[model samples]
Target: MAFVGVERAVRQILQDDADVFALVGARVNPAKAEQGPATPYVVYQMIANEHHEMFGGSAGLANALIQISGFSTSKSEVLDLREKVRLALQGQTSVVTVGADTFDVRSIHLEGDRDIDDDPRDGSDAAIYGWAMDFRVGYPEPVP
Candidate 1:
C-alpha cells in the first residue's frame, strides 16, 4: 500500500539531523532493523492512519500515529538517542521531500514514550535497552 509519507519523512528528518546522524548514522529502518544490526539504531512503523473526510467524501489530508524505536546496548546511549529523536521531530511543521515524494506536514507532535528492554534470545546475552516513542503526524494525502 502507498503511504501519505510520514514514514519516509521521519527517516529523512532523523538522517538529516546532525545529532541524530552522529548517533545512528544511516541505521534507520522502516519496520525492524536488520538482523544483528549495528547498535544505536532506529526503527519506525505506523501504528494507525486515518484519512480526513468531508461532507462529500474525502478530504485531501491524513493523520497518522507512528512509533519510533531507538535501540542500543547501553541504556545511556539509548536514552540519548531517544532524546535526539524527540528533539528532531517534536512540534515540526514543514514540506519534506523524500526522493521523488513530498509530504506537506501540518504538524508533528510527540504523543508518548516508554522504556523497553529486550531479553536476549539465548537467555545468556545482555539485554537491549530502548525506547518506543509515539508521534502524531498530520499531513496532506498523497496525490496519484
Candidate 2:
C-alpha cells in the first residue's frame, strides 16, 4: 500500500518553520474550502503520483506531485509565504516519521509557480492575492 507520510511530513515541516508559522499560524489545510479563514494562509493538495517499478513488477520508490498554494490580501505577502515554503521544502531529503512507519524522502524539487488572479469569494473589499507552487517529491515506498 502507498503511504501518505509525505503529505504529513510536508505539513509538519511547514508548520515547524518559524517564518511560515508566524504568517498563517496553523492554517495549513489539504484542499481547503473556496472561502475560509482570514488572509495569509496555505492550502495544499496531492496532485499526482508516479511509481517506480523494478524487476517482477516490484515498486520501491515513488514520486509525488504536490501543489501548495498561498493566499493573502496583498501580493507581497503571498509571494513571501510562497518563498518561505520553497525554502523549507526544496532539496530536502530526510526521514519523516509519521506514526510507527518512517518514510525516507529522497528529494523535493520545485516544478513551477503561478500567480492567481484576484477573486474574493467573500465579496469583501480586499483583493485576494494567491500564489500556486508545484513540487515533485520523491520518497521510498513501504515494503511488505
* Model 1 lDDT per residue over 1-144, tens place: 334367888888889899999999999999988877878899999999989888877787888999999999898999999999999999989877777666677999998999987665345587789899999999887443
TM-scores, all candidates, are: 0.90, 0.88
lDDT of each: 0.87, 0.84
Model 2 lDDT vs. the true structure? 0.84
- What CA root-mean-square deviation does each model show from the true structure? 2.5, 2.4
Tens digit of per-residue lDDT, candidate 2, span 7-32: 88788778878999999988998888
Q: Which candidate is the best by TM-score?
A: 1
lDDT of 2 at 95: 78
Number of residue pairs clashing in candidate 1, backbone atoms closer than 3 angstroms, sequence gap of 3 or more or interchain = 0
Deviating ranges (above 4 Å) for candidate 2: 1-4, 99-101
- Cα TM-score of candidate 1: 0.90
Task: Give Cα distance to truth, residue 31, candidate 2, Å.
Answer: 0.8
